[model samples]
Target: MFLLPVLLLLSSCQETIESKDWDTIEMPRVSVHDPSITSVTEDGEEVFYIFGSHLAQAKSKDLVNWEVPFQTEYEDLDNNIILGDIDKNLREAFEWAGKDDADSAGGYSIWAPDVIWNPNYKWKNGDKGAYMYYYSATSTWRRSNIGFAVSKTIEGPYTYQDTVVYSGFTQVDSTDGSDRNTHYKNTHLKKLISTGVIDEFSSNWVLNSGTEYNTDYAPNAIDPTLFYDENEKLWMVYGSWSGGMYILPIDEKTGIPMYPGVDSENQGLIVDRYFGTKLIGGYHQSGEGPYIVYDKETQSYYLFVTYGQLHSSGGYNMRLFKSDNPDGPYVDMKNQVPVFSSTDQNSQYGVKIMGNYQFSNMNKAYKSSGHNSAIITEDGQWMLVYHTRFTGGESHEVRVHPMMMNRNGWPTTLPFEYVNNEYFVSEVGDKDIIGSYEFINHGTTNDPKVLPLSTVELRADKTITGDVSGTWDKEAQSSFISFVIEDVHYEGIIVMQQDETKEQTKKIVFSAIGDNNQTIWGVKK
Candidate 1:
């Protein structure tokens, strides 16, 4: 029966070197939001281990099927849950940061976490191990703690280490170099907690410093990504919608800020002394989810971040900037402009890698595809792993996509979600490109679920047929596909990857986004 071969192919996709069909993929997950992956070997076999928000952790030998070993839910860390509503989380963090009354600022949730191997990290007993740097923040956007837990081995029940940074530092005004007490007296804030007096705190006051949430601190230490450069220098990039994104050098030995002392600017050890640079921000103040990957082949460091609200209906998406230097003056590929510029349209910069998109039929789609992590497999393949909320689905699920470089040296994602399939650089010429294909438009929608794929016919005469009428052509110089639908032009690169519906079938997939900010994904039928 047809079921036998289909089952065989699916098994091969997970267990062997055979090609995988995207349609047959059941993406692995634990509790998915902001999935970050790292590859390591266990017993001479490769494993793609995933970690995400809510302290969810999962691992897979083959990428398609996942098994969760542990998870830390919100209630697990809340002292109030056991004590009938007492704010113990912030108190412990503030105590570590040498402050009192941590109960003032009020948000409670764990966000994106970064797990990495610290080769030179030393424990008190002098044993080194892998570490997971994560955060806990109050919903009011006032208090946060970037803490870490370590494990003797890569796969582990990591023991809590310490709070690396307790947030709420007064912004560093380089102009004055003066200390501003951004942290409010805990006693005062607690008394005024019910009076809506916290509204006076500025969340995006970039120029001036204010108390608690209003501080102009550039490094909003929520989503932490620790990446080491080719030179083996460890760096930490963390931030979200408060001040902006920042990068800081890390002490290889202690796994803390390299220079853990206040600078001449009077900013504290966490804010000024260790703060590296403001990589990007200042748009709608929606910038969050900081992820950085250094591509040695291109001699560039790609800084990826989400630009909108991190919710299914909140227009969540991904954008990236590249820099030759690790701590950088990061710029976009186009015009060599700052990725986060006040003059330019901010969202217009950085390659829009993935967003709310659909492919095939109503069964296949993804939305709010941001808060990602990148990994280079042991076999030297590149992948962008993230979590997405599918159409008609309210839950977040992790998805992986192979990242490819276009003719311009910038990276673009293949149209399909990765399914442990073998993909190759597309070499089809103009003559071979004209054919019948399935086109999926990531139509703007608040409904979280998949939409049906439509049919499109690419004609040799540069005209389109079938479902929706459009003109298709390729750029003469770059050979990138450019097509017009509804008078909008989109440019894209093609790659040969597995078609979602057919097992062992390879097809040309085109992924592009229109000027109207709509993304289109097409798979050759």
Candidate 2:
């Protein structure tokens, strides 16, 4: 009888050791377009915040569970916690760049606001606060101006400060003599001339005198993203389609541009003295929403930008480039430099990190996954935050994906939406990786069409067969994996994550980037 009891106890212990108690985690969803993410400490707890276009804002303690604190509709302006009264408070910006109903029938076209805590910024009362860099645009694509606002807290009733950069100004304005040129001269050029950043006779001093408003050369002056370099120097990268993107060093004390003097020698296409340095995308090529983050481990500055339009049918997708210096000769995985003139296509430029794609398990295919912001968490975890639209409609939702650098020091996102601790793979064995999977090869295309998932099987003999042929292997005692598919070498990281599309079933997944810069993702069936 005692022997029987011992055997029962051993069997129960073995059962307990083999089975896992998976947690049921439900994530709260929010719709915030052009989401710019930042973190702060609130009530002694860490909270992640995302502020986006049209005054939309949301907060979360754990990234999965979000609470939207502000709405995006124009009718809800009064309820906005960031800019309390949009019309009254932002009247100056409206007068400068807001579109009239005759123009677009929309209220103010506020867009792409980025917030950062600036300890160096001293308010009127000598208190420091977070700075909100925002833009206002008229119906005209290039007609916009970038400005800043200040608030005592991250979630703020921010007060407008000043409008810094202006675009789309012409030689003449309205018949009332309030022309764009006059406005530019009085509001911006006078300061630039006074500071010796530009000469009074310089063509750039007058918007119409040169191609300043020309979409082919000059920037659209929107979508501002601020970041600090390794030396803690503050810099701002802003611009959109029409011209390419540009970067300007910021004055940390005043929270404005520290003009890099003038670049009179070479007016070709690259550097601009008054507007700053042009990093990539020019001559009206399709590229916008430039975001840069420095990885300490790789010691490189990664620049991410989206190509195509923002609409659901538009071929909006995220691309990646990197450089040793912040102001860069940024190159893609294929080592191709960004196109400066309209002669070359932008789809052939940057590493197309992700485009529209869908797995077999997904109900709807995701489309236009662009305008992203990435952050390295306090605990050194990298995450990509972006807005993605679906196939059925233009409606969008925010998504967070955990990121990992491959053996080549290139960053690739995991195959699923982040779920707190459920996605962490401590030690994945060969049994976990060898199985049939739904695969997606995110090819180097900047299109709105979704890449449909196909089937692939990983056999015990280290061979892959099905939709594509390949040979796979994993590093001993590590989650890193390698595959040679049809002569292309691919490196990736594998993890066991709960499949959100399937009834939260735990499954193994892999996200890998190929030698040609194309990305491939797999979810085990």
Candidate 3:
């Protein structure tokens, strides 16, 4: 058969990942966080940045680590970002609070912030169409209201706007007092409204289950975040302490809350309190950073919390729970409790131990590493970003670590070590720490089967055992055999390459045991 030039070319053409593509690369963030940061996350080439009324910083990275070179307040806006001077209203809004410093937010103390593109508007001119919303507390002792900011790109030098919405009033300029903006009228939000970015949320409504299902959003409720469901509708979930969290449908037309009023008319309803009921208390045992995450793999929703008291010794810890819905009946998977916790005696604290000991490698000041939010990398690895106190009494710094669900479906921060090595990789495939390979029975004649991938155990004397044990150079490269203090059978995947340029990879699984304070490899499984 004769083939045309085009047909021949098509027949010969195939996609190939060069050996260079097989290079074992990893997620770029080593420890990304803003000081006193409530959340650290990514959306695009930009690492969208906002801190607790402290600073607004952004990082841009193409492949690996985010490069954070942009940090600004109102003054640096136009020069560094797209929508810098465009939001004249935002400048007028923040003029009073004196956003120059959190301690001196004029009267506004900026809190939990969420940044996303302006869904309603496409990028053009300098307005790349990004927006930010944050809960702002005027004082440490009072309730705070959510504020607004607008920018061009996800990596923003967002323009400082005014406190469009606030707690404590329905209409800041009410005459007769029947404006029906009551959803925000009574709460700390009073009647302030958040301008939820258009693209990030659902523009939908729920069928009435009961009057208790307000489904109305509030401006005053704290820790507000604008998110979208898989269906691409815009939704806003916000609230703090006394009211719990609420989810309300949004008006795509105006970026405002859409709710049915008492008249069953557009009396303007609010979101139903989604998490903990009034009787149930806050989502966290107390409610601080009520961040939500969606698991694409399981199609489940996760609400993460920074629980307990960081002021106490060994108190602060990052905790989380899951549910089938975004606005959920979030339950702590580990305990079936209402909220996530690590108060358990055996393995309560969920902070990632950086070295052999908590105080050994990390800063000794382990006062708190709580307030957390979850993010998935572009490559799809889950990471939890939280702040840990410096061990030696330094300023609280933020850190990022890979996270995962345990065999029990509960979430756990990646441990500090893997395969007995201090640093660990969190990718799959013939990459650094995952791949299919052979197993050699070296530990006694029992030759018990290893967990899944090839596994070997090394005794306390530091020797390989179980399936296979030999001086073979190849086995060492492909995998490793390690052990814990209990001197039981343990194994791990050792990422080795043939002089660092080969695509070959292997999985070496091992077992270990230990209390929460330590790990000891034991038993097969």
Better of 1 and 3 by lDDT: 1
413 Cα displacement, candidate 1 (Å): 0.6
For model 2, what is the alpha-carbon lDDT of residue 22? 19
> What TM-scores do the predictions have?
0.72, 0.88, 0.53
* Clashes per model (N, Cα, C within 3 A): 11, 2, 62
Cα TM-score of candidate 2: 0.88
lDDT of 2 at 490: 90
User: Tens digit of lDDT per residue, candidate 2, span 458-506?
Assistant: 9999999999998999899887899999999999888887766646777
lDDT (Cα, 0-100) at 466 in candidate 2: 99
TM-score computed on alpha carbons, candidate 3: 0.53
Alpha-carbon RMSD of each model:
11.5, 13.5, 16.7
- lDDT sort, best first: 2, 1, 3
Worst 10 residues of 3 by lDDT: 1-10
**RMSD in angstroms between candidate 3 and the native structure over all alpha carbons:** 16.7
Provide the lDDT at 387 for model 3. Answer: 58
Overall local distance difference test of candidate 2: 0.74
Global lDDT of model 1: 0.59
